[model samples]
Target: MLIGEVARRSGVSARMLRHYESLGLVVPSGRTVGGYREYAETDIQRIFHVESLRTLGLSLRQIGQVLDDPGFAPSALIGDLIRETERRLAREQELLKRLRAVDASGPTAWEGVLRITELLRGLGSPSAARRQQAVLAAEADVPAPVLAEAALAEADPHVAGALRWALARAGEDVVAALAPGLESPDADVRRRAVQVLADLPGDEAAEALTSALADLDPQVRAHAAIALGARGSAEAVPVLVAMIIDGVNDVDAAEVLGALASDPGRADAIKRALTAELADPAAPGPARLRLVQALAELPGPIALPMLRALVSDEDRTVARTAAALAGVIETQDGV
Candidate 1:
């Protein structure tokens, strides 16, 4: 076949086939008597091979080596191609995300687009200070969803705080944006989501936190419980009680419970929960002692009876502490 027929059948342009010949990658098998290049079946096959390698992101030079060097082990080259492809894909995805974010900002002009782009660049900067400045300088311009995403991925404590603060001001849209982070497979991401949600005002944020209360991570659960309790949701009661028993942030848990007990019905429930723990013989000494201290946070009248009963308890430390607390309550109550 002539070069034209080969180019037509193989889908390789004639110019590219000539370029390949120039590089000595694929030379036509023969020449016509009139001097035009001619190609044999084997030469066309080599042309197809070069094109196949190009699809795998191989440079022309690498393809030359691959086609010429029979001893070349492709494993290392293939691995390198995979890594490079992954990096290129990551960059493309990031660029797409930035474009979407900029579009979401509803920029009306090129300047607005540039501003949003610069802000996004700062948010993604490696320096924590730059990330923080991006958030602090955002004002009402940067969209809430962007801030929420940055908040979830931010590793620096200070920058994370700034992101959360920005999200807090970004309004209810932030709640929806943060929803996916709550379901993230990464525990740290979920924890950060809960932390940001804790500061977000509104029932939606509270509802998101309610879902987080069931999170498998103890810290995630604890943060959710505290946030819920502060929101006056009784849903946090069980976790708060558990915190006391486990001695994990027991003091804060007790204080929130005490505040919750301002409601008469909730007060009764709180009293019963504490008494039940105290009655459990299997309860550890430290846990029981912590429980005793927690009870002291309750209203004087409500805590006094439990405190009085515990005064002569089996554990001397418990007895002395209870005795001291009860006496103080009695003196304060003028009983």
Candidate 2:
């Protein structure tokens, strides 16, 4: 088969296929005397394995070694894959738990909390709750946030309250381990702080969250906007609105802000964020899109003009979002 056929069969782009070749993961089985690359059925099948290994979370270098793994039998290879998958899943679980438990800097425990947390790490990722009763007993040895995270999935309000009370006396060392997860190294630590700050209650969290606004991650800035919506601060609206208008991830950021803007006080903040960009000449179509959506959610004569302007905008995508907004308004008004 030709290179194109290999790409078609493997669902890997031709450019990436060339990259794989450079990485030495695959080589054409033969070449024509005239110099055309020729591949065999075996080579195409090998490409699928490469794709599979990449999907399994192995880095290219790691994948290369996995392909070259020796002493390990087939069963051993499967076990390794399962272990890796579990590790990722555990990280996600930890992130979600932290999201639920974070309160703010106040009175929290440090020593006992660390002891309790080892129990969690011992849970081997997703089996996090397998040792529940023992964990709850040692819970006082953990951080309040970690304790709260551990109990987030439960429904009983009384149980939840009890957990919160326990969180009050959690140890400091445990607090250190209660960090959030992020894919980017720089974004990771800051995002973790942001998650904890936003979830934690009171003035300390507010101060921390304000500082987190300078985070380089657009996604984090957008999330900060949504978190502000819950707390209903006039100060955060402009930044969130600005992000909705011009941030690269405006679509997601706009959606979060819109959801949080239901409170009357937040309306003006979001409107302020949107109105400036509603008429911005240099901003991209998506900026206009999120702004229009935000304006539609607020619903006022101010937005109607922007919506009208959008109907005739140069960008088809912006015009489309505006048209949709107009339709939503018409539906609401019984037009």
Candidate 3:
């Protein structure tokens, strides 16, 4: 059985399972490729037996010797139990006296209680401390996969968020890699699901992008738009342009789509995106400015009319960006 299954079945935490193995009380049946311990049916039985002996106060060494010799005496275990009871009784008495003194004296005599309380609350118990180490080893970013292997960890928010961002930037073909995870039933698994589908290029990624665009989460849609742009899909161009046009209030989507026109082959598409915005009389000033800049990057006589008109644009930033592009195009021509 896997360690998780073993832990579930045995009512012992996985930590104790390895601890038992280390003490030579139980042996692992095998190991996973990641070196995770695997155990057999017999390992559980051995653990149950060892736990019984421990409750009866067998020292670990005593247990080991007993395992090798069926004739081992039970008197040694009885003596160990007696000693443990005496030590516990002494400590209990000491703590009880201190508790009584503190209770009778009141807060003035107990200034250290507040500090002790904070320390106790803030401190990590030894068992709880191992959780951080386990998370570090399991999280993808510590050894984050390149290309398309980024994935979420349920327990670590830092790892989950980082892995999602990495997958978001993992290039156009990354969508194909996330195909299986998109259908995953787990919510944590669902978080990084959309990035994979949206990164696929062309019309192939459009339906996925459309679905992401319609998702309830804005981040999901924003990432979808980014993936669509990365895929550089012409089909996505119109949808992306429309979204940018309607999304003037959307800073992130605007930023992602604006970056697209800066790409070489998409210059005309950016020009078209801008022209579409310019034609919309209700367009926001900021959105129009973004459109004007996108056009400028793809500067040509095709946008000369729009440029000349934008030179007199009501928004100063729009005119400024339009003028800059016309100057650059003119300068390039002169070159």
Clash totals for all candidate models: 0, 13, 1
Cα deviation of 206, candidate 2, in Å: 2.0
Q: Lowest summed lDDT over 10 consecutive residues: which window, candidate 3?
A: 138-147
lDDT of 1 by residue, 63-165 (tens): 9999999999999999999999999999999999999999999999999898889899998899999999988898586787788888889999999999888
Task: Report the C-alpha lDDT of model 2 over 1-335, residue by residue, as the tens digit.
Answer: 87887778778888887888899888788988888778898888788887887786667876777676765365666677799889989989876754344323322566434554455554324443443443555544444555544444333444444444454456343333334322236664455445544555665556556655666787666566566656766556666776766655566555556665566666566665566666668877666666767667554444566687778777888788888888778777766
Cα-based lDDT at residue 311, candidate 2:
89
Among the numbered candidates, top lDDT falls to: 1
lDDT of 3 by residue, 1-335 (tens): 88889888878888987887888778888888999888877877877887787777677787777776889887877787799899999989756744543343243534544433222232222433443333333322222222233342233445444445555554444556555555555544544666545433456556656666655554565566666665554445655565555553245444555566566677676666667678677888866766675554343555556677788777788888888787787777763
Candidate 1 vs candidate 3: which has greater TM-score? Answer: 1
State which candidate, 1 or 3, has the greater lDDT. Answer: 1
Off by over 4 Å in 3: 1-158, 161-191, 196-207, 246-270, 299-305, 314-317, 332-335
C-alpha lDDT of all candidate models, in order: 0.90, 0.61, 0.59
Q: After superposition, how far is residue 175 of candidate 3 from its true place, in Å?
A: 7.4
Clashing pairs in 1: none
Question: How well does each candidate superpose onto the true structure, as a TM-score?
Answer: 0.94, 0.47, 0.40
Name the candidate, 2 or 3, with the larger lDDT value.
2
Q: Could you arrange the candidates by TM-score from highest to lowest?
A: 1, 2, 3
Poorest lDDT segment (10 consecutive residues) of candidate 1 = 138-147
